[model samples]
Target: MDEVEVVVAHSERATLRVGDMFLKVDADQARIDAEVAAMALAPVPTPEVLWRKPHVLAMAALPGTTVGRLGGPSTGSPGAWAAAGAAIRKLHDAPLPPWPGPGRRPDELRRELDEECEALVTNGVLPADLVTRNRQVAEAALRPWTPAFTHGDLQIAHVFVEDDEVTGIIDWSEAGRGDALYDLATFTLGHEEHLDDVIAGYGTDVDLAVIQAWWALRSLLVVRWLIEHGFDPFTAGCEVDVLRSRM
Candidate 1:
């Protein structure tokens, strides 16, 4: 019998790997549905869905390692990062998904950020100056944008590659119509060194300022959630460093 390896386990969801199969257990049916639908609609490679039962969805694992992970060195070459960027561009070019993405509403994001910022300052999780500076930087991202098909969480860990070729991207539950830059920003969050390579493959002019703003915005918004979920945002090359870099 194949031993089940826990890939990730948090309050919201847990993923397990048993041999070649990856099983995702999510409590939210809607999120699962969206993941399935997004995978079907995405132009890029995705895990092969085997079966789904209630809150559990089974899939065949893709054959490649992630390009990199936050707070860790990226083992992939520049070409691999560029390939991932090209794949992202393809997804963004595809027709918009039927459902709206979580990033579509900037006002809601502002409110959430405000709350989080207040909590961070009041609780002394981060110094007020750091929070204030990042908030100011984050404001640039809270503006109108032309919606595109987006992988709402395009963290480096979600993109898989082998030998400079993008094999697949995973974790599509947040996929929907949203700002394209958000995806770009998420992809290059901790791996800022690869931004140029990514932009080269993206094959279009990008707003560096907006992308920078997203780095701060995303880091700030997720720090608290990451802590609560047993993730260490303060790791040397992680979210806290990303925010500190803005200082």
Candidate 2:
């Protein structure tokens, strides 16, 4: 037998790769159920569920490299990004999942954003004006959206590519019904240069303003969580840069 490969070992959960299978162990049962349910309904390519228990879910490993890397260039060609965009379009066009959750309600987000901005400013993680400016910019994304099947955390790393095609999308934990542009923003965060490629592949004109707003809003919201988890958002080519870019 081969050694177990620790893919990600965060405080809340950990994923291990063992002999072509991935075992995801999470503490939150609801999140685990959401992941399983979302994967089962997504229209795009996803891992095959091998089995599951209360806290552990096993899935078949996917083939191919990710569409891009975080904080760096993607070795995948523009064609691959386009392919990923097309795949996302397919998913967005699918029927809504039964469990979309409380969702990002504007009132909740406004309050949450205010609190997160205060924390960032109060703790000096980011400058006060930077948070304020980004918060104002984030307002553009607060409008109501027609909910689509959204991969809540659609980073390029979650998309796998082979031969300029999307082999599969992984990490269905955040899958639900939400703003389509939010997923677009999440994927393009810190990688704005590739937005045109992804949009081209999406086969339609999209509202870039909403997507940009999401970039700011999402970055502001996640930095604190990243910090609490012992991750550095200010490191090169990461969330800090994404927030700063808005300034």
In model 2, what lDDT does residue 96 have? 93
The per-prediction tally of clashing pairs is 0, 0
Candidate whose lDDT is highest? 1
Candidate 2 residues lying further than 4 Å off, grouped into runs, are 1-3
Candidate 2 lDDT, 55-138, residue by residue in tens = 899999889888667777768889988898899999999999987654679888989998999989999989998899999989
Model 1, global lDDT? 0.91
Candidate 1 positional error at 62, Å: 0.8
Clashing pairs in 1: none
